[model samples]
Target: MAGTFYRVQCADCENEQVVFGKASTTVSCAVCGTTLARPTGGNASIEHEIVETVESR
Candidate 1:
């Protein structure tokens, strides 16, 4: 199976970052300490708007 990546923009700071779709841990914004995604049983739950889909290897 292929892993999915997402380019998400932080709502608080508008910081953009790439995150794994099936992340096992919480993801936060680099610029600001805002929560971006949370680990779920399946794909991660995104807290911010997704800007684009990123290709991962």
Candidate 2:
């Protein structure tokens, strides 16, 4: 199954970026290099603030 995308804001820099819900690798913030999400078998463990949930159209 396909996973959704999330618009996440970094806690340290407030930089907004897209992250995969089912990411297999660690996802980091673009501007601050902060940990945004991590792999957790299924849905990623999001650490930053999730501003929006993107649905595939």
Candidate 3:
């Protein structure tokens, strides 16, 4: 299966980050150190709002 990338904005600090859609571990914000997404076996459980779907090259 191919992996997907997401552009998410942090709820606490308004920081933007790119995360893997099928992440195996919890993802955090780089600026604020807040929880952004958690692994959910399939797609990651995102805590922040998804700004856009990033296209991989």
Candidate 4:
């Protein structure tokens, strides 16, 4: 199956960004530079609020 993606809202700046569910590296907020997601070797550890889930086809 295709990997999933998540729309996360930054807690500090409320910036909405699309992040891979299995991101290999750390993901930061686009506007605020806050840590939004962290690599966990599997699904990324989301640090902010999850706005939506994106499915790959």
CA-lDDT, candidates in order:
0.92, 0.90, 0.92, 0.89
Q: Which prediction has more favorable lDDT, 2 or 3?
A: 3
Could you say which candidate leads in lDDT? 1
Clashing pairs in 4: none
Write candidate 4's Cα lDDT for 1-57 as tens digits: 568989999888888999998899999987989999899988889999999987664
Better of 2 and 4 by TM-score: 2
The better-scoring model by lDDT among 2 and 4 is: 2
- CA RMSD of each candidate after superposition: 1.5, 1.4, 1.7, 1.5
Task: Give the lowest summed-lDDT range of ten residues in model 2.
Answer: 48-57
Give me candidate 2's TM-score against the actual structure.
0.91
Clashes of each: 0, 0, 0, 0
Error of 1 at 27 (Å): 0.3
Which sequence of candidate numbers ranks them by lDDT, best first? 1, 3, 2, 4
Error of 3 at 15 (Å): 0.8
